[model samples]
Target: MKRLLIFYFLFFPVFLLSEKRDVYAISDGKGNIKLFWLTSPKNYPSGGWRIEEEKTNKVIEKQLYCGREEFLNALKEEEKGLAKNFIKIFKDDDKEKKGKKFLIVLEAMTNWNFAQAIGIGYEIKDVPKGKVRYKIIGLDESGKKVGPHFLSDFLDSSVETLPPDAPENLKAEIILREVKLSWSQPKEKGVIPSVFFNVERDGKVLNLNPIIPSGEDSSFLDKEPPSLMEVNYFVYGVDVFGRKSIIKKISIYVPDLKGMVPPENFTAEEKSGKIILRWKKVENSSGYIIERSNLSNSLYEILTPKGIQPDMEYYEDSNLQGGSVYYYRIHSYGRDGKIGPPSLVAFAQAKNQTPPPKPKNLKAKVGRTMVQLMWDRVDFPVAGYRIERKAEGKEKWDRLNEKLTPEPNYNDITGLYTQGKFKYRVIAVAYDEKESLPSEEVEVELLDTVSPNPPRITNIESFDGVVKIYFEPSPPEEDVFNFLIVRGVSEEDPGLVIGEPLSKEKREFEDKFVKIGQRYWYRVVAIDKKGNRSDLSSSRDINV
Candidate 1:
């Protein structure tokens, strides 16, 4: 009994193992290998095993599997041996031939165990100079299969290339200020078409629409035109295949001031010793009326009747006195008693009748190294006058005096420091201080003088990022002189003085520092070598 039991345990398992079959094949596109195994009647599990390449050797991917129908279907469709050659045998021959085939795809270029178990195979298509490969593997019954096999040789690799061309029948139109667009579908079936349109104005992209379906006509009216008034626009087109066509420009004119009356060009200016007013012709104007006022007056006086041409823009005011200022305005009256708003204010000053009086003898004198000038005031009861002077080397005379009194004599003659000869002249003042005819001038030469007094520092103040020092330069005999600036932070630190010995005529200096939010105190003084130094100017304190 013990011996029989031992034989039964071992023999039963062996009998079951023989009932199943493992089948596989290899393919290199052009050729194929197959296997067949004799087996007793037994049902195999629906899934199968596979083998693939890892650089060199054929490796098994044990757990890797696929459905029978899917495996067979992939083989028939692709004609790739990797999946089709691996078959599961059954008791019925016809059923075996018709069973589905599952093709298992494994990631190439990896060391994964399951990927190795399935043999790697590929299908190839024409790509440039080389073949474009799609990888696949196989699965079979008994959970044992071989190959991701190469099946490129089995495929038709010939392919055709087409030149890029515009999508057919592309058209765009503007409707009610919106752009409506349409285009023909691509020749290649199942190709997704994309469309793009842009609204352009003055070579600028005013609006853009992208990624629309082909064969679709659409409108994109710009709700807001580029400006408050009307403008022109153009349309551009592009198809899904990235083909673009020339732009179609369209002009759109928007009316300005629609239904509103146009304004006439009303102008006012001084002419013929009077205020003249003019305007453009108004077709239906009843007549034009002129208004006048003084500088201080606010009321306007109408001076014309109806039925007069609004185009007869000219109007003159002769009832004004000389040297008087006046303001004028105009308006249009319709037959319906409608009056336009007052035109812009026009102003004119009456021409001057009084002549300017002759300037008195103008004389120049030398004081130390400086030239002192004096003249008799203008004789007329006028506004004012100007003075002019020129040196021997100068080509043009310069105005040296202005707005002198109406008295008989005046004195200036200051700021002349040059040693050469100089000439001078004066003119009378007219209306509004306008200078009139010139008076004869006298020539004079300035004498050289000794150095002037040095300037003195008066006061100092410090503020944010800067220190301000104030001083007065020494007054010299010659008024035409400039001053130099110098500064120092500490009173006792002579070495810390910032600049060379500055001119005594300098009045102020500002120093900048990097430190902030600090308090500083400063002092200034005025000195003149020719004159005594004034007492040190007041000191100032500031925080920066």
Candidate 2:
């Protein structure tokens, strides 16, 4: 009885383990393997199962999973509970196929939970490659039982190049003004490792760059897309080797925008010679358009340039008539070029303090004894014209007309004898004494003078055989066509003409005809463009 009792205790557990069947091995995608099977109803053990290599007769990985929760926790997060729904509807025909879903033995496998599935996996570093065979042994309160063996076809353990395959089942979920995309990875052999994807919308790339999906589940969220009414999305899978697969496309409709808000807090004020308008910035607005009318309900005309940028909140409308009642309205534009409703109409009466517009097309005519200046009349009412003049190349402008002149033309009699250039400007003065900006300046040349001021000998140094003379040309040097160098022995005697006339710019002359050790007198006279010569310059004596 003692021998029989000991034998019965060990052999009874082996007899129960013999009932467990359908044991199989699966690769966990990592360098790991897993084992699963179903045991007879009400026969599953209290302790978990142990996976063993059938060929080597060695235990590879062991785990204690006595319940469904413990079985799922033993697998990777992505693989956990993946087959639960399929297993719930599993039938005997599911085990007949070559690539089939097998049932795993769970701790809940009472008579009612007979079909409950469970799985456990670990790193396969200890197992050899090729046709891997594994068996599951049920661990009970007694010793573990060596269950029946199942085989899996050859699994290539060597590293390989995995080509990226087309993404599957692309779905876009529309949120307000945005979209969220999710998809499944390609099937087994074509699945890419560490793969990323590029997102395109309506044939245009949307993402700043390509991106890898977060977590093992493939998904991408588009926070801020374009402003289109409908969007078509395309996702392209690309592997680390830059291989691109066919695109996964989906179309979705987004909620239409309510349009940009009209400009707010709009106000206008009369400033120096212009109407200054200001407003608060509008959200999602590309720019603002301003309009104005002389009277309320009158035809309003666009006052701002098209596409005027809204970045600057203030705009100045210049040249507006003073003492005028102006009605103004403004509207904001969206990026799509749709205009929003106009803001509340704002009105302001421009103060009656502005001067008339500046005179245009100013004209100056030189006369024998005076200069006559004329300009286009200002269209509006003006008190009179104010004339200003400045010498050529000079910045200081002196008023030529001491008092306002009723005529648009002015006669400059004071500078009639000055043989140089002078610039003239015209400004209109309002009845209120406000002065308009200066007109485009007009330059006048006073070449009516018949003769230029005589040239003066600046230096009369004598060379070994020549008298080198230097002289400064007279005022209105541009009018001096040439110079006549006169030679004589005394100031009382009129000097004889020297060599050919010297040009106004060529003031220095080398009198090579002069003899050394002789006293000679030199004088110079400037000739004007009219061929008139001036009185002789002061004589200078030089020993040559």
- Could you say which candidate leads in lDDT? 2
Cα lDDT tens digits, model 2, 1-544, are 0011111122122111112234323443344443435444234444556666677867765643433664455444433443343333233344453132222222121111212223322235534444556656666545455432344333433332244566677888754345788887555342433245778876776766555444334777777765546777898876433456677778875432333467779998877766888899875678888999987787889987585686868888875666666888998877677666688888876654546889999999887678889898898767689999999889899998778998888899954356788999999986556788999999978765667788888888876687888899878788799899899977677989988988778878888987678889989998977777888998999887
Candidate 1 structure, TM-score to reference: 0.23
lDDT of each: 0.44, 0.64
Candidate 1 lDDT over 153-237, as tens digits, reads: 1111233222222344545443332434444433432211123455566676655434232223433455444322346665554
For candidate 1, the 10 contiguous residues with the lowest summed lDDT are 105-114
Per-residue error for 323 in candidate 2, Å, reads 39
- Regions of model 2 farther than 4 Å from truth: 1-45, 62-119, 146-153, 159-166, 169-179, 182-220, 224-282, 288-544
What C-alpha lDDT, on a 0 to 100 scale, does residue 386 get in candidate 2? 91
lDDT of candidate 2 vs native? 0.64
